[model samples]
Each structure stands twice: as C-alpha cells, then as structure tokens.
Target chain A: MKSLLQNLARWLVPVCFIAFSFSEEPYQLKLAMSWGSDFPVFSESPKRMAERVAKMSNGRLTIDVIGSEEHGRPLDVFDMVRNGEYDLGHSASYYWKGKVPNTLFFTTMPFGMLPLEQYAWLEHGGGQALMDEVYQPLGLLSLPGGNSGSQMGGWFQKRIKNTESLNGLKMRVPGFAGEVLSELGVVPTNIPATDLYEAMSRNVIQAAEFVGPSTDFNLKLHLAAQFYYTGWHEPGAELQFLINDEVYQSLPADLQAILKAAMRASAYDTYVHSVDVSAQAWADMRRQFPTIRVKDFPDEVMSELRRVNERKLVEFADDNDQARRIIESQLGYQAMMRNWTLLSDYSYLESIGR
Target chain B: MKSLLQNLARWLVPVCFIAFSFSEEPYQLKLAMSWGSDFPVFSESPKRMAERVAKMSNGRLTIDVIGSEEHGRPLDVFDMVRNGEYDLGHSASYYWKGKVPNTLFFTTMPFGMLPLEQYAWLEHGGGQALMDEVYQPLGLLSLPGGNSGSQMGGWFQKRIKNTESLNGLKMRVPGFAGEVLSELGVVPTNIPATDLYEAMSRNVIQAAEFVGPSTDFNLKLHLAAQFYYTGWHEPGAELQFLINDEVYQSLPADLQAILKAAMRASAYDTYVHSVDVSAQAWADMRRQFPTIRVKDFPDEVMSELRRVNERKLVEFADDNDQARRIIESQLGYQAMMRNWTLLSDYSYLESIGR
Candidate 1:
C-alpha cells in the first residue's frame, strides 16, 4: 500500500502541473531589430540574446528575430513594440528623439560619459528609474541592448586645425551632433548612408562621421579621407531593447528572470565583442592604409564645440520639465563620476603615454 | 476504446518521464570563496551568482557558498575545488601562481591591458583557449568572476618624485608588483588586512597599496597617508570563478546552461557595480578629507618602474613554456588593441580634459 501511494503521488504531481501550469506549451515572441540582416555586431546581439534565452529556458520560450530587411521599417521598431505588433525591439533610444524628446538622453550625448561610466549612471545613479519614467507611460520597457564603445569624431578630407576650418564645411553628420556642428557654421547635411562615400569622394561633403573603424571600414571611408579624428560626440553609444509591458508582465516569474539574465549577458558580450572587432579592424586599417593619419581637433576648436554644446543643452532643457530633470541628473552624476575617471583610467593612460 | 487509449497516453507520458528522469531531486553544490564573509564586493559576487542560478533553475540547482571566515583557508580555494572538497571556488587566478606558474597570466599584469582589453582577449583573442590549456589538465574550469577596475598605485606618507625617493621606502604591496618594487630599492612588505591600518599609523610601513577607493576607503588608509598616487600595476584586476570539472559534468544540459548564463551575468554586474561604488567612495573621501592629495609619480620614476617590470616579465617567461606563450599572446594582443584604445577612450578623455 505504501509503495502504491508513493507511485500515485509522483504521477499526480506531473499530471496536475503539466496540465494546469501552462509550462508545456511554449511561449513564442517576435523580435524586430533596426539593423539589416547583414549588419555584423549590431544584428548579432539580439540574435545571441534570443538563442541564450531559448537554451536557458530549455525551449519553453523562443524568440523569432526579424531584422530590418524583412521588417521594411528599421525606425519603426519603437512603434511596432509599443503597439504590440512586435513583442520586442532592438534599436537605439535616441533614434526616437523626434517622436519623444526625452528619448535622446538614454543614448550617448555629445561630450558625454564613456561606456563604463554611462553604465554606472544607468545602473546605479538613477538613470534607469528616469528611463522607466519616460517609457512606462508608453506601456513600454527598455533594457540596454549593447554599446558600440567610443565612436571616432569623423573622417576629414583635410586636417581640422581651428574653428575656421569647420566654418562652411559640408559634413554628413547626424542628429544632435549635426545640430551642434551647425551652430559652429559647419553645414550639416543629411545624406543616405549609401551616398556618403560618393558625396565625400565627389567633394559634395568634405567630411563624414559614421561609426568607429569597425563599421566605418565597410564604407571605405579611409580611402576617401586621409585624416581620422578622435571621438567627442557619441562616446559609448548604447543601443536598447524595447519590450511591450503587457507582453512582459504576462510571462511567468521564471521566464521573466530568464529573459532578463539572457539580455544582460548578451548585452555585455556585445560590448566586449565590439571592443575586439574594432581593435582588429583598426589594426587592419592602419596596416593597409598607411596614409590615414589619426588627428585630434585643435584645442580651440574643441573648446568652441564644448561651449556650443553646453548652450544647446541649456536651451533644450529650458522647455521641458522631464528634460530638465534628466539633464540636471546627468550633469550632477557626470561631475561626481568624472573625478574618479580622471583619477583612474585617465591617469593610468597618461602615465603609460598612450 | 480509442478515446480511452488517447487519455491514457497523455497520463503515462508525464508519469514515465517524471519518475525516470529524477528531475525533482535537486543538485546542490558547495562553493568556497577566498574573501572573508564580511568582504563587500568580492563576497557579494558569488552570492549573487548563486542566487541567480537558483532562481533561473527554479530551485533544481542550488549553490551553498562558504567564505574564508568559515572555511579557515583563504588561499586554499584552488586546491579545495580541485580536490572536490568544494565543488566551486571564488578567487583570483594569480593567487595560485606559486603552485601553478601559468595561473599568473589569467589575472591582470603590471602595466598590462585594462579590463575591457583583457576581456576582449579572453573572449575573442584566444585567451580562453590558452587558459584552458593550463587548467583543463588539473580537472578544473575557470571563468572570469569580477573586476576591481583600476587600482590606485598606493598611499604614501611622502611624495615619490624619482627613483631615489623609492629607495629605502617601506611599503605594503604584494605579489609580482612587490617583486618589481624590490628591484627599484623599495622594501615591499606583506601585512595582514586587519593590521595594515595600524602598521601605517605606527609608521611600521610608511606606505601601502590595498585596492582602489572602494575597498581602500574601508581601511581608512587616507587618514594615515595624505598622498595618493595613480596606478601602474594591476590596471584592471579581474577575479576568477573555478569549478570542479567532474561536478560540472554531472549537471543536466539545461542546468548547465542556466549556471553559465547566471555566472556571466553576475560577473559583469560586479564590474559595473564596482565602478559605481568606487566613484561614490572617491567622492565621499574628497568631501570628508580635504587634505588627501592625489599625486602621480614623476615620469623618470614611472619609466624606471616600467623598465624593471619588463625585465621581470622576461625572467618569468624564460623558464616556463606555458608562461612564455601567455606572455607572447598578451603582448601581441595589447599591441593590437592599444591603438584602438588611444583613438577611442584616451583621445575622448583628453579632448574633454578629464
């Protein structure tokens, strides 16, 4: 009788749980990415996250990823996820700044913190909560997808010696950086990514800023330009993962934990991968293109850019309460953290003569 | 009869699988940590990793962590895990250099690559394979546990202006860095963590290097020494997680996946957490202790230290084939990556004057 009861109990447990708990039926999610199918590191991050989630969950949850080439709306990821047309999105938050003003702060800003510093702000210094405040109202959730590390300033056809060199210069820069460049008398022109190389080659634009060496090398920018400038704008540009609140809330507790863990691991993996890719690409570029000279904008030009950036930020914050709050928070955190950065990485690099 | 057979099939499937698979039985592993129970970030990392594993596995796999205070063998974690006395260990790889010569390269080196650079090597540039060559023979598996960011050089009672200033200076610094300092005429002493504060206060040791501000502030070294110097040694010190290969192989595939994902997430979290903690602590120290001045060793002294460090590395590599291979790999990878670092983060910092 005792042996029979034990067998009966084991059988009853699996039967009841399997039938009622909904664990047997797999939950499928659709993810849309802003990057095209062939995009290297950018497209790989979301796919890696999805793969990890599936394995970790033992196939209980699966995510089907569709890149921009299939979706035909690279920039519509935000709306697709928000409206439940897609369950998740992989894109940059700043890409939505035109639709939502506060979205810009989540990505890298001109003269902003580096990758680790920005991560500190996001994880510990109230940046995440502020981000939640903005996204929660739209019934959306956002997670840091990955970082591109620090981007280079741009590729210039000629050396930028002073502020005068920037005046009347036609450059294909984008977004907030374009605005800042326009303030300095440079004509910031918007050109399709495909046309960027031709524009520069034909003297339609004298300079152009794409990503760092890893992605920019694909555009053959080094062949058209002799000077590669150091980065100021888009230092540690972070991409984001967007999820519909309803879709996320409907998942089981364990699945939620699994998804978050997978996202976190993949996000970090992408950053480390980017560092390796960029290092290798930069090395290759230097070896192949001996004429490409790395340059820094003159101190006077850098100072003028900083001054203009600060003024533009003030004007941006003056109108919106949420924008003001975010700007103030970022400024305060940057002030506090910058001292540590100066003492740690900056000092170490200086001592080594990098 | 057909309907009855269909119903019976469903019930029998769950019963047979659940009973035969033994999925209900839990796998519990014990982890021994090198840090004391009260140690802040170091102790917290393994605990967080264990918690995530438990949640993600839905309690099928659990880890019981015992710190050094409980185990009474802080430096014996590598042996303990290897002998299967503990299934896992949380410690730094360099701690085992005396027992295994190749273990030294797995951790940070003096004037070596920074955290991200080292991580890039481990993840992409053939580092993990080399590490496996050393550890796999011992029936051990190692994973990156956490990073301490950039460590400050040390706290000094007097300014170190040149090589002469280092002569006859008694300092508490340990391991390979101490060996380098000894060559420069500085007396390197090892003091217990509990006794370092008193040793500095009584002038038993005129200077000491613990960690950066996050951990160092806890020792209150700033109160005894007013001069804080920037780092040259252990730029980005990474810790390790060691697992018994036999124990790891005993786990189910899904559980194995869960454990790896959890460890990866927690390790990155600890690094991001350390940046925030160090920044906050450094800010607090500045506000509370106005007289604590941060200093950098003069260029002559820095150059001398570098020369000695390079010589010592050559001596270290001369005897062991594995050590030579790791050293060569690190040097080559650093040469390739440093250019990217300079063009990216270093230039960005200089442009902002940080």
Candidate 2:
C-alpha cells in the first residue's frame, strides 16, 4: 500500500509541473525600432535584449525585432506600439516632441548634463518618475536604451578662426538647435537625412551636424568637410526603449523581471559599446584624414551660446506644468551634480593633465 | 480508443516536463563579500544580483550573500571562493595584489584610465581575455562588480599652500599608491580600516585616503580634517566580482545566463547609483559642513606626480609577463581613448563652463 501511494504522488507532481510551467504558449513579441536594419551600435540594443531574454526565459519568451526598413515606418514606432501593432519600440524620446513636448527633456539637452550625470538624475533624482508620468498616460513605458556619448559640434567646410566665424555660416541643423543657432545671425536649414551628403558637398549647407566619429564616419560626412568641431549642442544623446503597457501586464512576474533585467543590461552594454566604437572611429579618422582639425568653439562663442541657451530654457518653461516641472528638476539636479562632476572626473582629468 | 490514447499522451507530456523543468533541487550558492554587513552601495550589487536572479530564475536559483561580518573573513574572499568555501566574492582586485602581483592592474591604477575608458578597453580592447588569462589559473573568474567613480586626494588636517605642501606629509595610503608617494618625499603607511579615524584625528597621519564623499562621509573621515584635495591616485576605482570556475561550470546554461545577466546589470546599476549618492552626499556635505574647503594640487605638483607615475608604471610592467601585457594595453588604450574623452566630455565641460 505504501509503494502504491508513493507512485501515485510521483505521477501527480509531474502533472502539476507541466500544467504550471509549460501550459502557456511560448511568447513572441514584435519590436519596432527607429533605425534601419544593421544600424551599427544603435540597433544592437534590441538585438541583444532579444537574445538575452530568450536565454533567460529558457526559450519560453522570444523577441522578433523589425527595423524601420522592414516596417516601412521609421518614425511611427510610438503610434505603432500604442495601437498594439508592435509590442515595444526602440527610439529616441525627442522624436515625439511635436505630439508630446515633454519627451524632448528625457533625451539630451543643449549644454545639459553628460551621460553619467544625466543617468544619476534619471535613476535617483526623480527624472525617471517624471519620464514615467509623461509616458504612462499614453499607454507606453519608456526606459533608457543607450547613450552615444557626446555629439560633435559639426563638420565645417572651413576652419573656424574665432567665435564670429559661425555668424554667417549656413548649416544643416534642425529644430531646437536650429533655433539657437538662428539667434546668432546664422541661417539654419533642415535637410532630409539622405540629402545631407549632397548638401554639404555642394556648399548648399556649409556645415553639417551629425553624430560623433562612429556614425559620422559611416556617413562620410567628414569626407565632405575635414574640420570637425567639438560638441556643445547635444552633449550626451540618450536612446530609449518603449514597451506597451497591456503587453507588459500580460507577462508573468518572472518573465517581466527577465525582460526588465535584460533591457537594463543591454542598455548599459550599448553605452560602453558606443564608447569603444567612437574611440576607434575617431582614431581611424585622424589617421586617414590627416587634414582633419578637431576644434573647440572659442570661449567667447561658448559663453554667448550658453547665454542664449539659458534664455531659451526660460521660454521652454512656459510650455505646460509638466514641462516646467521636468525642466526645473533637471536644472536643479544638474546644478547640484555639476559641483561634484567638477570635483570628480573633471578634476581628475585636470590633475592627470592628460 | 482515441480518447484513451489522448489521456495517455497528456500524462506522458507532464512526465517529460517534470524531467526537463524543476527536476533538480533549487540551486543556492553562497557568495562571500569582502565588506562588512550592509556596506551601502558597495554591498548593494550582490544583494540586488541575488534578488534579480531569484526573480529571473523563478526561485530555482537563489544566491545567499554573506558579507565579511558573517563569514568572518574580509581579506580572504579570493581564497574563500577558490577553496569552494564560497561560490563567489565581491571585492577589489587590488586586494589580492599581495598574493598575485598581477592582480594590481585589474582595479584602478595611479593615473590609469577612467571608468568609461577602462570599460571600453575591457569590453572591446581584449581586456576581458587578458583578465581571464590572469584569473583562469587560480580557478577563479573576475568581472567588474562596480565603480566608485574616482578616489579623492586624502583629507588633510592643514590647508595646502602650494605644490610643495605634500612634501614630508605623513599619510595613511597603501599598496601601489603608497609606493608612488614614497618616491616624492612623503611618508606613506597602511593602517587598519577601523583605526583610520582615530589615527587621523590624533595626528598619527596628517592625511587619509578613504573613498569619495559617499563612503568617506559615512566613515566620518572628513570630520577630522576639512581641507580636501582632488585625487590623482586611483582614479575611477572599480570593484570586482569573483566566481569559482568549477562551481560556475556546474550550473545549467539558462541559469548561467541568468547569473551573468544579473551581475552585469547589478554592476552597471551600482556605478550609476554611486554617481547619484556621491552627488547628493557632496551637496549635503557642502551644506552641512560649510567649513570644508576643496582644493586642487597645483599644476607643478600635478605634472611632477604624472612624471613619477609614468616611471612607476614602467616598474609595474616588470612585475610579470602578464603584468607587462596589461600595463601596455592599458597605456595604449588610454592614449587612444583619452583623445575622444578630451574632445567629448572634457570639451563639453569646458564649453558649458558651469
């Protein structure tokens, strides 16, 4: 009788295990991204996230990443995910500025905090909660996907002798930055992404603002102009991941944890990967293009630009209550954190004198 | 007959599921850390890693983190993990430098690469493989556990007048930094961690090197002396996680994936968390301790320190063949990445000039 009862208990345990673990069908999520296929370090975030999630879930959950080229709607990721056409998205938060003005603050700002400092604000200084507040109402969730370090000033057709050289320069700068440049007697124009090379080569635009060396070299923007300027516009541009709220709620707690942890790790890895890629590309650029001049805007020009930036920030505060709140929070946090930044990495670099 | 066959198939499916999932006993690994219990951000990595792993693995694989207080062995983490007394450890690589001289290069060095630069080297510049080469022989695996940004020059009892102020200064600094200081007419010595406050307050040491404000403030080391100098030694110090090779190999592939992913996320999180904590702590310290004065070592002293640091690095290379390889790789990589750093973050800071 004891042997028979033990046998019955063993069979019951297996039955319970199967029903609990394998009863749910394997989950396959469709992810929409802003960039086209194989977009170098930028697209690697979703790819790695998918790979990690599949492994962590023991193949129980998988992600199918579709780039903008395949999806035929690069800029519609926000709409697609919100409408449930895609389970998630990988894109920059600033892309939705027309519809959601607060989204612009989450990415980089002109003369704003660097990546580490910005991350500190986001993670601990209420930036994340503000980000959550903006996205939660739209049935979407946003998290930091990656950072591409600091963007360079631009590839200028001619060497800048002083701050006044930018006064009459025709440049291909867009949106908020364009407005800032316009205040300094410069003519800023928005050119389509595909026309950037042609515009710069033909002197239609005398200078172009792209990314740092990695993506810039890929675009051969430096080939059009050899003078690369150090950046102040977009200090540290951060990419973001967008998840649909309903889809997120549907996952079991374990799977949800796996998804978040994988995304966090992938996000961090992407930043480090960008650092490596940009460093190598910058070195290669210098070696290949011996004429490449890396110049910083003169202190007077920098000081003037910051003054304009501060004025623009005051106008930006009038957008709405939420915008006012985020801008104030970021400014306050940056002021507090900048003291330490000056004392730490900035001071360390100065002391090393490297 | 068909209904009976269907019933049999259901039973067999469960049997297979039981064998594949939840078939083994729950994996509970003992992780020994080098810090005492509840050691703030330093201990948060393993604690969070264990929490994340438990959730990701659905409680099948749980880690029991025992700090040095409970384990009764703070300095023996590497040995404890290797001897199978603990499956893993959280500590600095330099802690093992006395036993394995090559271990000195893994943590931050005097005038070495900063955190991001070193991470770029480790991830893409063959640093991971080189680190593995050093550790694989000891039946241990090491990975970056966290970074505390940068170490500050010790708090001094008296204000520095100039570059020559450090001459004949008695300070409580240990290991490689102590060796470098000894060359510059400063007396360097190591005191136990607990007695640092007493020694500094009693004038046993004129200055003391703890960590940045987060841990340093917690230690109340700043209270004894208020003239804080900027750091040159141990810039961007990174802590490490050590895993026993045999124990690591015993886990299933999915569990291994979960363990690694958790540690990576935890490590990155710890660094960001430190930035936030230190930033906040520095802000609070300035407000609460208005008497505190932050000073930078004069340019002449900084230049001389770098010259001596370069020489010491040459001597460090002669420690072993592997040490030579790591030192060369670090120096070469730092040279390459520092250009980008100067152009990007450094230039950005200068332009903003906040």
Candidate 3:
C-alpha cells in the first residue's frame, strides 16, 4: 500500500499539479500603448500599472508596454488589439469615434462631469455597464486607464471675445470641440503634432488645443500662443485599457484580479499625479513666460458654445439607441452630481474667497 | 530507470518543494474596522479590500474584517493594532490625535486642501514620506484608505451672518473645527452620535456637524436643523488603513503587492462611491425636505473663521518638528495647487454660468 501511494503521488504531481508550474513561471503579456515611451503621464501610467502587476503577482504576471514609437502606428492600437494583434492597448476612447460613434461619450464631452463625478457615474451610475455594452460587443474589454484632470480649452494667439472672435480663425483643433468651434466659424484645421508649433508660430494656425498644461508644455505651446484659456471641452479626459476579451479570459482568476486592481489603482493615481504635474507646469509657465495670459471665455461666448454643443449632442445621438442612452446617462448623472459639487467643492472654494 | 526516477521524484516533492503547501494553503489576516458593520463607505471599503485581496490571491491570502461592533471599542483600534492585537485596522487618522498630535494632519484640517488636492500631495508632493515619518516610529504602516469627499460645516437652525451669530451657541462640532469655533465664542459640546439627533431636535444643542450628505443622511441631521451649511472644516477627511508592520513584512511579495493595490483601488472607489451616494442623499433631501435651506457663511464670517483656523494651525504646529513639517508641506502644496484648481475646475465651473 505504501509503494502504491508513492507511485500515485509521483503521477499526481505532473497531472493534478500543473497549476504549480504555471504559477511558478511568469506569464508575459504585450501592452500596446498609443503614447510614445517618452510621454510623461500618458506613458508613465502603464509602466506603473505593469510594475504593480509584477510586484503584486510575485513575478507570476508580467506586462511589457510597447509604445506608439515601437508599434509604428498610434491610431491603429484599437484595431490591432481588437484583431488580437496585441493582448492589450492603451489609448483614449474618443479616438474610435469614427469607428464607433458612441465611443465619444466615454472619453469626455464639450461639457460634462469632472473626473470624480464621471467615476461615480461609471462605478455607481451604470457608466461601466454602458461602456461594457459598447466594448464587449467588439470582443474587447475596456477599463479606465487614467485621467488628464481637465484639458485646457487650448492655446490661442488672441483672446476669444465672442462668436465673432472665432470667425475666420484658423486653428489646429480636432474632434467634438472642433465641430463646435466650426459652428462659430472657426476653421478647424488638421496639423500634425510635429508641425503644431510651426503652424502656431508662423500664423499658419492662430489657435490650437493640445492637452493640459503638462502635455502642452511638452509641445512648446507657450512659445506659440499668448492666451491660454480655461477648458470647456474634455473636462476630465479619461484614458482606457483595451484588452482582447479572449486573451483576458485566458488568464487565471488571480491574475485577472491583479490586472483589474492594478489598472484601477493606477488610473486614480494617474489623475492625482496629473493634477500635481499640471500644478508644476502652470507654475513653470507663470515663472518663465509671464507674458502668457490665462483667460476665460466671456459668458456670452461660453453660453453660445454651450448652446451649440447641446444642439450637436442631440444630432450626434439622434440615430443610435446606444448613443442616446449614453448621452442621457451622462447628462442625468452630471446634472445630479453638479449639485453636490456646487454644495461641497465649489462652495468651499468660493467660501475661502480665494 | 523510470521506476527509480518516480521514487526520486516522490521523495523530492515533499522535501524540495514545500512551497506548494504554503502557496496552496491560505494565509488569513484579521482586519479591525473603526466603523460599524453597517457603515456606508467606511466599512464597505475594507470589505471591498478583503474581497479583492481574496480574489487576487486565489484564496492563498484572506482578510477577515472585524467591525467596531465586533471589536466593541472603536477608538481603541489604533492602540490595539499597534499592540499587534489585530493584524490591521481601518479608522480615521485623527482618532489618535490625542495620542499623536501630528496624526491630526493626516486625516483632514480646516482651510486645507480638498480631497483630490490632498491626494495629489500624498502621492506626489512628499506627503506620503512625511506620513511615513509619523507612522514608521509606531511600528505601524498607515496608507491612504479613503476620502470623505468634503465634510459639511454642519447643520444650523439659522444662517451664520457674522461672528455675533456664533456667540454663546451650543453645538456638537468636534476636533479642530470645534477648537476654532470655541475661539470665536461658540460653545462646543460633546454629544454621542446616537443622541445627536435627539440633542438637535429637542434643542439640547442648537447645531451639529456630521459627515457629508451620504453618511449624514443616516444621522438625519436635516430633521434636526433647518439650515444645512456648506463645509469649511475637514475639507476632505481621509480615512486610514493601519497595518502591523511586522505582520505586513511576513507576507509573500505577491501578497504584499496584492494588499497594497487592493487598498488603493478600494480607497479611490470609496471616494467616488461616497460622491454618488452624496448626490443621491442631496437630491433626496431636496425633494423630501424642501424646507431645508443650504447656505454658506457670509464672507465676513468666513474670513474671520479662516483667520482663526490659520492662527490655530501655527499654534498646533509649534514645538513639534514633524507637525511643523507636515503643516508647512500642506500649506505650500495647497497654495501651489490652488492655482491649478482656479484655472481648471473653478474656472470651468464658472464658465458654465450655472
């Protein structure tokens, strides 16, 4: 009986305990990033997530982040990941608006909830489910990757006084904000990021929108524009982690949890980190380029832009049920959350009389 | 040869690979929460942490959360956890202010940074290291647990127009805010939470400050006082996760990572969740109790309160190097980050003209 037990144990070690070998060796995953390796917050967030996953999994899981420079195509990340060319991809959701119209709402809108408010909607107010509905159908799983706190309205050579100020102005603006600007007679032109500085410097384009101060600082945008306006678009631009569903399902349950938790933590950390970086960049801009003036759109200009944005949103959602649903969810959640914001943060901030 | 190899493998499996036993079997830790089991975001956060920890560890690590009801003494958590009586503890940092004065800085403060700004400080602006200086000495590890969004100033029967309105007023406000108010001739009283609603309704105390709308909804403070004032004190109250350092060191590298990541994700989720719940509570309060008026203190009263809060901060920081260091860090970070807030969030909100 002892001999038989010993023989059985030897066989069981190879067959029933294959999981030991799997756990002992690390599982390597490919993460395709839309941002270059040198990009500050955009690139750094994924590296942090990868590092956290490796540490937490005790080397059981490893994620290699391949940047846009290495991938050779930033815009193709979504399609490549969807086609299983990569196990994962990091990019903004709105980048896929042409491919999927409803995708725009997930990133941010002309005017929408702030990052925390949007997160509340995602976690507690059906935003995640709506997101899943959009992504799961395409064999992809989308998770919040990071936030840009708030995107600056853009850099402009001249202050925007009203709708007339936008008229006949050429700008390197894109997407939904571009569409809204076009309504006010701003000529939204597409300029490669590399030429954005030249375009603005040489009067090829008089206005532009990059990201927030941290990212815009990298573009040397301060050298190009004098007026830096506050944001009306992309109030809290959230990035996404795009995973191939089949590849995601192939992971062991423990690894899935590690991946999920790592992404979530890294996403929130990224937002706070973005805020810190923005603070530094803003301070730098003030100290180095005191010539730069920070401006807000006049109430009349803002109200007109808001009116046009509302009209565009209606048209944008008119055709698709999913689009309409997402729009309604965002609208309702923002309305309700804005009240709390007014009462808590806005009230507290104004009370200080700062 | 095969039979000899089988025999060798059987012998080696038990001796050469004892790790399987440790990995296959679970390591369970005890988590003692300062809040009751039924507590909203406070208790739910730890439970979420445990669940995520369990899932990520695949049962290799388990955390059993014990609420205050089970622990019997809520305020004793910091001492008990420090004494190694519990493996972990979840409570507000300020609870230990009497024992460790510097700890009061960790939770929240009057005229301090908001939740997100404070998070930025903790993550990027050397706040965590300063926190480590305070905690590492106690043989404990304190981490960012969750944020209470913004704590409301409190409930009042009437508007606070000026310093005269504060004179001789009996209120159940506690901690640093209470100290500042007392300096302004207001009488601060200690009342048990269970008796708070009765105290306010029966005119035992004219006013009281609970948590924000979410947690305060449970206390039904609106039923006691007609005027619901916005927050000034405890701008963003952060809760803490207390871990026995030695117990933490005993965990495997993977489990440690899992633990840290789980806590972080849960902390952020709690803040967002708190926001959602607060929105619901505020909406409910508006619809059900239309008589409850929301007000901010007059600018004169606010400036006076701010002056006293700043004065008390200087006094609070005196004599303690760590306390002074923490205060200087907060004040400086707040001053810098407040610019970003005004340019981004505050500016955008104002542009909406809502």
Better of 1 and 2 by DockQ: 2
lDDT of 1 by residue, A217-336 (tens): 989998889999998998998899999999999998888889999998898899999989999999999898888999988899889889999998898799799999999999889888
Q: What CAPRI class is candidate 3?
A: medium
In order of appearance, the predictions have TM-scores of: 0.95, 0.94, 0.95
User: lDDT, candidate 2, residue B14?
Assistant: 54
DockQ, candidate 2, comes to: 0.54
Evaluated against the true structure, the overall lDDT of model 3 is 0.88
Local distance difference test, candidate 1: 0.90
lDDT (10s digit) by residue, model 1, range B306-347: 999999889878988888889999999999999898889988
**Residue by residue across B264-326, what tens digits does model 2's lDDT show?**
999989989888888888898889898998988777777777788888777878766787899
Per-residue lDDT tens digits for candidate 3, residues B1-354, read 655655555555553344444334578899899889998878999999999999998888899999888989899999999998999999989989899878888988888899999999998899999989999999999998998898888999877888899999999988888888998888999898778899988898898988877867778888888988888888888999999999999988888989999999999998898888889999988888999888888888888888998888778789677888899998999999999998998888988774
- Candidate 3 share of real interface contacts: 0.66
**TM-score rank order:** 1, 3, 2
Q: For residues A178-220, could you state the per-residue lDDT of candidate 3 as single tens digits?
A: 8888888999998877789988888999999988889788789
Query: Candidate 1 - CAPRI tier?
Result: medium
Per-residue lDDT value at A9 in model 2: 54
Residue A131 Cα positional deviation in candidate 2, in Å, after optimal superposition: 0.7
Q: After superposition, how far is residue A168 of candidate 1 from its true place, in Å?
A: 1.6
